[model samples]
Target: MDPVRNPYSPGAGRQPAALVGRDAPRSSWRVALERIERGRSSQPFVLYGLRGVGKTVLLSNFRRAAAERGWITAQVEAGAGKSLRESLGETLHAPLADLARPSAGRRLLIALRTALSFKASYDANGIWNFGLEAASAPGGGADTGVLETDLRKLVHDLAAAAEEEGVGLAILIDEAQDLAEEELVAICAIAHAAAQDEWRVLFAFAGLPSLPRVLAEAKSYAERFLYERIEELHGDAASEALTDPAASENVRWEPSAVKLIVEESAGYPYFLQQFGQDTWNAALEAAITYDDARVGAAAGRATLDNGFFRARWDRATPSEKNYLRAMADDGDAGSSSGTIAARLGRKPASFGPLRANLIAKGLVYAPEHGIVAFTVPGMAGFIARQPSTD
Candidate 1:
């Protein structure tokens, strides 16, 4: 098979050739977009799942749906130590700038000019410009001196601009779990105010399982969020993910080969693409063979280990590596902290700060009392295969 014709995409956050088993949510979101256009309220969505369950991809798909409805949209990935105020300010610039604000032209111009001015104070390398002072912070700028208060004003202004332009604004945020509790509440405030004023704003965020609790704490209204929990694809959908793309390229996959690939992947979308790409490159016959799947599985192990797992591994200190190894030794999908502590030859109580740090890093999460699980799917197996040098 020619590699050029390989339709599967295996990169991080890359959209697959065929998005499978997500039709329900996609259709629901399309309806929500339409409702916003008609000045009707819709429950906003927050997508939650473990790593590799396609939250980012689904967010991307939803953004495209909003675009089709002629709505203004912005998608951003939240990162550690990054200010949501700064990110939203920067991302909202273009859409708000492009908005037809003729009625309120003077007021919006003053606000946006002040907002973009703040971005210039920081350089490409993140070096701050010391000894630089601005004449004034725009009264309506999102980057107000305070995060919460200013964010509300900023959001209100953008929604006003969008409503004036006869369009709705959609903000899709990825890695919402990275946001601090205070930041989440600030966003909830923005949403609450938007609804109260009947402004045209739609928000969707994708994050790990921990997102709901923080969001709920932010506002009681968050309880009504359209929570979509992404999980492994159904068996039929998983099979279609494997077979349909190949068939479109005029290549067929044997039943035996498809069965082998699906079984090995455990219906994970990213792993499916990993297997599909490697298997296609390994195949020689017109039809994919079971042997090709075996080879692909072998190839995928190294690809996942070196590319995916190693990135996290490289970031771990010696103690963190040993801590992870201990968890891997005691684990299936998850294990009790006490068990991991025993494996590390320490008392569980003493590991409290370390456990908290891991949670903050998005490496592991507490599913319930006393137990922790990897944020990423298949992470335990990858950790088990690592050399135990630490």
Candidate 2:
């Protein structure tokens, strides 16, 4: 096998050669885009799932599709900053500034300025005019610095500006579960106002399974936004993810070999790519075999250990590491806090801070009240292999 001809790319946020098992979300999203473009009220979107479930890939694909349709689009990550205002202002400035409709562009700019003013962390000059001869002043209504009150007006006015420019504005935000309560409310407010005014704008977010809870806490009308679960690929889709790319380049996967990798990967997109890449590298001929898959699976697991799981493992404090090891010993899915605490020789209540800290680090999450689980797929196996600290 030629490593140079390897078509499989397994990395963070890397798009699979063939995106599989996403017809439902993609079709629904196509309709949502059209609905927003036509000024028809449609639910905002939240694609919630586990980490590495391809939420970012799906969001990026949607943003790319919107851009292809000439929609004004901005993609930003949540939790990288204190507030979303600065990142959004920076994101929207480029697209809106180049719109060629000065009046409409100014409205967007004014909204941006209003948002930017609240982000004192953003230097005044950091928000550039993009060489456009501009005279837009910040509007009083949007510059109030009250997130709930002002964000609605800002996004509403931006949608109006988009309408004027004969385009629509859509933002794709990732890691939405990390958004502050006020930030989430401000976002919900924008959507609420958009629905009332029929604004030609959309906001789509991608986050972990707990995103619904976060959104529900932010606004009572959170159900107005449709949530899609991006689970792992399935039988046919999973097979295609492994076979199609290989077939494209004159490499053939043996049927049993394909089944082996797909079943081992549990239809997860990342694992599919990882196994495919490793299997391709391990095979001696054009045909990938079950024997090759077995070797490749071992190689891929080692790779994930040093890269995927190791990164998270390194981030844990010694006590946190022990906590994860205990949880890992319990099972693959989730463990009760009581069980993990018992493993660590402590009462459940005494481990509250540690559990919360692990969740905060994104290494673990509470699937239910008092139940903890690893955020990454196959993490429990990686943790279980570690020598116990206790």
Cα distance off (Å), candidate 1, residue 143: 4.9
- Candidate number achieving the greatest lDDT relative to the actual structure: 2
- State each model's CA lDDT, in order: 0.78, 0.81
> For residues 334-356, what per-residue lDDT tens digits would candidate 2 score against the true structure?
89999888887889999989888
Model 2 residue runs over 4 Å out of place are 101-121, 130-133, 136-141
Tens digits of per-residue lDDT for model 1, 1-390: 789999888877999888999999998998887787788877779999888878999999999888777777888888745678667756765665555244444435544544444444332344222122323424334444566777666566556556655777888889987876778888887777776666788889899887887688779998888999998887889988888899899899989999988898888888899889999999997799999999988898778788877787777778877888888865547889999998878999999998888887788888777998888788878887877773
Backbone Cα, N, C clashes tallied per candidate: 0, 0
Best by TM-score: 2
- The whole-model C-alpha lDDT of candidate 2 against the native structure comes to 0.81
